[model samples]
Target: MSWLVTGGAGYIGSHVTHAMCDAGIPVVVIDDLSTGFAEFVAPAATFVEGSLLDGALVEDTLRRNGVRGVIHVAGYKYAGESVNRPLHTYEQNVTATLTLLSAMQRAGVEAIVFSSSAATYGTPDVEVVDESTATTPESPYGETKLIGEWLLRDVGRSAGIRHTSLRYFNVVGSGSPRLFDASPHNLFPKVFDMLYRGETPRVNGDDYPTPDGTCVRDYIHVADLALAHVAAARRLDDGLPVERVYNLGSGAGTSVAQIMTAIRTVTGIDFEPTIMPRRPGDPARIVATGDLAARDLDWTMRHSLEEMVSSAWEARRQAGDTYPR
Candidate 1:
């Protein structure tokens, strides 16, 4: 049976699709191409262009592909932008997830790996976040993710569906030069786009209570993150024990200033980032420990900061004018 990956044409989803394909796992990708690129999908996988909001289409894709499990990566991912568009966010993330789950149930798909977010923690008071950290999401995007998790939990309990939710912050770097992050909301791509056009990158709020007076956040390689999803899927396929949740984190933090420095070093361009006022509700630091994932899913920080920067920069440069502005 094949595995269905929702949003498999998106950045992180495409990486997971590549990893699953590399692992010899048959994959079926269903994406609406809303923010995802159709060309980003792996050539080996089956691609279905549709939205999860269409329960009929989702169910048909799953049954027709003999899908045994799902990797739910499709959702409204921008936490900041979600604030102004709460209803839209709920429709895309929460309502869509509900529809997907219902479709999965109808299709007899009994396994899933959800792409959750650290935004569920919402300016956590603790220096480092763990799975036990209370979820107090401040944005509609985060709340929808938490609601998705709740849906999974309730379904798992009632329907005996095996599932796990992976919580993470920033995902960077590329495993293939042909694949690149095209999100306008993400930091790495945003900076790379600015540099591509000879525009100065801006750093918001450099006066935070971090080591370098800038916000410290967790950043993990997208390729490495994709591997964990494959591992988790394997565990489920083999009927092995799996946790309800895992944090694919770095167990350390990287400051914004440090990232800028790495970008300068990688690009071999000397340009100071323009310091702008801190955006409201910006947290000083939010990192997580991936100890559980390390033990169960072979999770590790395989790529260094410089490698992350250089790989992402290379892919962004390769995309050139082809990437959507």
Candidate 2:
């Protein structure tokens, strides 16, 4: 059966696309190229340059490709930026997802693997959040993701739409040798860019209630995240359930300072970062419990910090003139 992966040219989506293609699955991609690269799209998959807001286009694409499932991964994802542009967050993430779901209803495409986020949990009192954790999103971006999950849940209950919403934490590392996160919003790419220019990466906050006082996040390699998606797809194919929500993460918190140290260790750069005030809407530490993903999808991450950092560094170097320089 054919599958449609929205935003398949993006970093995480591209990795999923690669994994799907490698498994000999027929895949179709729909992306507007707003923050994604056209070149990053897998050549084996059919690509349609469009927006999720276009309901008619979405329906038509589904019907034409005979798409059996969809992996929705299109959305705005910068916490600080989402706080500033809440309207943009609602429009692209919430509204666009509703449009896509509506189109899915019309097309009768049931199974879907939504790309949710750990931000949906916000800053909890607990160190690690699990699937059962209450979703009290702190930022507009997080709220939008929670809204997307709600859409999936409500839609499934109302209509017979089967889905899996994979809530991911801090997604680090590169997917392919060429496809990298070129977004200015991400931490790893920004840090890599700074170090590449012989400059020290800026530390946003260094006074939190953590070991090093830096904001700590659960870092999962992009490839590991892709494997989780693949596993979810297989589970749905086995006619498991109507809806599932899994937390894809390492369940370990890695501080920003730890990440910087890893980068330095990988690249041998002794660049010292300039500590700045905490960016608005950023929580101190957000890690995952990661039990549901393992139990439900039989998924686990296997990339070390050094390996992840080294891959990202190499991808950054290859991205040289290809990236928006």
Candidate 3:
């Protein structure tokens, strides 16, 4: 039996696919090329070009591929942009997840590892958040993700579907030179893109209470994040107990300014970032403890800030002209 990785052609999803493939897990990837590149998918994994919104296609893929579990990762993931595109976010993240769960039930697929987000704990007041933190998502994208977790919980209760949601923090770095994060909204790609074009990187809000007067975020390498997903999937496959939710975090915070410095050092690009006004709804700091994930999924920050920057920069440089504008 194979595992189905939805959105397996995207940055994080592709890394997960590679991790699974490397671990000898047969994988089937279904992705709509909206934001994913087909070439990013692992060569060993079967590729299905479609959207999870298509219930018929999803169910068909499950039945035809002997799929036993799912790693649901596809969604409209821009937290800031979701403010102006609430409907699109909900449709993609919420409704599409509903469709996927319904399809799984019909196809008798009994396990799922959801690709959740730290956005679910928007602007948490605590210095370090755990799974017990209150989920008061501040954006439509965050709301959709929290809703996705709720759906999985309810489904697991009624249908006996084994599941776990990995609420990871800012995922950065590239596992391979060929697989790069191409998001126009994420920090790493944005700065790298600006540098490639000989433009100054912009940092929003440098007047915060942080050490460097910028937002502090917990950054985890995409490769490390992928390993946790595989561990959760294996736990499901082996019928081992799994938590309802786990935070795949670094247990530390890095400010935007620090990230820029790391980028500068890694890329050997000496340029000060252009500081801008604070974006609305921006949190000063949000870090989480990965104690639970560490205990259960062998989660840990395997890469340092330098590695995160250097790897991403290497991949961005490798992409060269093909890197999405």
Candidate 4:
């Protein structure tokens, strides 16, 4: 049975496709290439270049590929920008997901692994978030992610479709030199670009209430995240019971200063980062405990900060200018 991975040309999605196919699972990819590159998709999979908004194309892709399940990773993923463009965010993430679900139901596809985000939790007054953290999303992007989860929950109850949502913290690093995170808003790429250009990386704040005097966040390797997706999918494929939502994260988190130190160490940059004032409403700390995921979905922080930085650097160098600026 073939598994359909939407947005398979994207950074995380492409990595997910690679992980699944490496396990000898048949895979099919559908991506519009809006923010994704067509070159990132693996040639082994049957690829369809299209958007989830195109209902007919989605249905056709599912039916044609005989997809038994879907890994719904397609969405407008920028949280900060979603605040400025809420309509576009909802249309792409929420409405587009509805379209995909409709096609899945029509094609008798009953299993899905939704790519949810930690943004669904917003800023909570908790030390470490778990699956049960209160979901009060602060941005359109986070709201859309929550709505996608709601869609899966409601649809599952009504249609008997087995599904799960993997809500993760900061996703960084690359599994292969051929694949790297190309997001402009992401920390890894930003620092990578600066160092490559012989510029000092900038840290937003360094006076937060933390050991390192910087905000702390869970940072998981892209490869580790991909492995969790495969594990979740495997559970569904084997008819094993799994939770509706799993938080893929590190129990503890790395601070911005810690990250900067790692980046400097890895890149051989002698300069320290410039510390600017914290952005409005930026929390000092927000980490999650992946105990549930660890028990069920084989989730773990398999890569260290140094490893994450090194791998990302290697991939960015490999991509050269082809990587997004």
Candidates' lDDT values, in order? Answer: 0.94, 0.87, 0.95, 0.92
Worst 10 residues of 4 by lDDT: 316-325
| RMSD to truth, every model | 0.8, 1.4, 0.8, 0.9
List pairs with backbone clashes in candidate 3: none
> Which numbered prediction scores highest in lDDT against the true structure?
3
Give the worst 10-residue stretch by lDDT in candidate 1.
Answer: 316-325
- Candidate 3 TM-score, C-alpha based: 0.99
lDDT of 1 by residue, 1-325 (tens): 9999999999999999999999999999999999888888999999999999999999999999999999999998999889999999999999999999999999999999999998889988899899999999999999999999999999999999999999999999998898899889899999999999999999999888777899999999999999999999999999999998898888788999999999999999899999999999989999999999999999999999999999999999899999764
lDDT score at residue 277, model 3, on the 0-100 scale? 88
C-alpha RMSD in Å of predicted model 3 compared with the true structure? 0.8
- After best superposition, candidate 2 residue 298: deviation in angstroms? 2.4
Q: In terms of TM-score, how similar is model 2 to the real structure?
A: 0.96
lDDT of 2 by residue, 1-325 (tens): 6899999988989999988999888999999988888888889999999999999999999999999999999888887789899999999999999999999999999888999998888878787888888888888999999999999989998997888899888788886679787878788898988877778789998999899999988899998888888778877877885336788777777999999899889998888889999887677888887787888776787889998998988899998966654
Which residue pairs show backbone clashes in model 4?
none
lDDT of 3 at 177: 98
The C-alpha TM-scores of every prediction are: 0.99, 0.96, 0.99, 0.98
1-325, model 3: which lDDT tens digit per residue? 9999999999999999999999999999999989999999999999999988999999999999999999999999999999999999999999999999999999999999999999999889898999999999999999999999999999999999999999977999999999999999999998999999999999899898888899999999999999999999999999999999999887888989889889988889899988898888888989999999999999999999999999999999999999884
Ten residues in a row with the worst lDDT in model 3? 248-257
Rank by lDDT, highest first: 3, 1, 4, 2
Give me the displacement of residue 323 in model 3, in angstroms.
1.6
Off by over 4 Å in 4: none
Model 2, residue 300: C-alpha shift (Å): 1.1
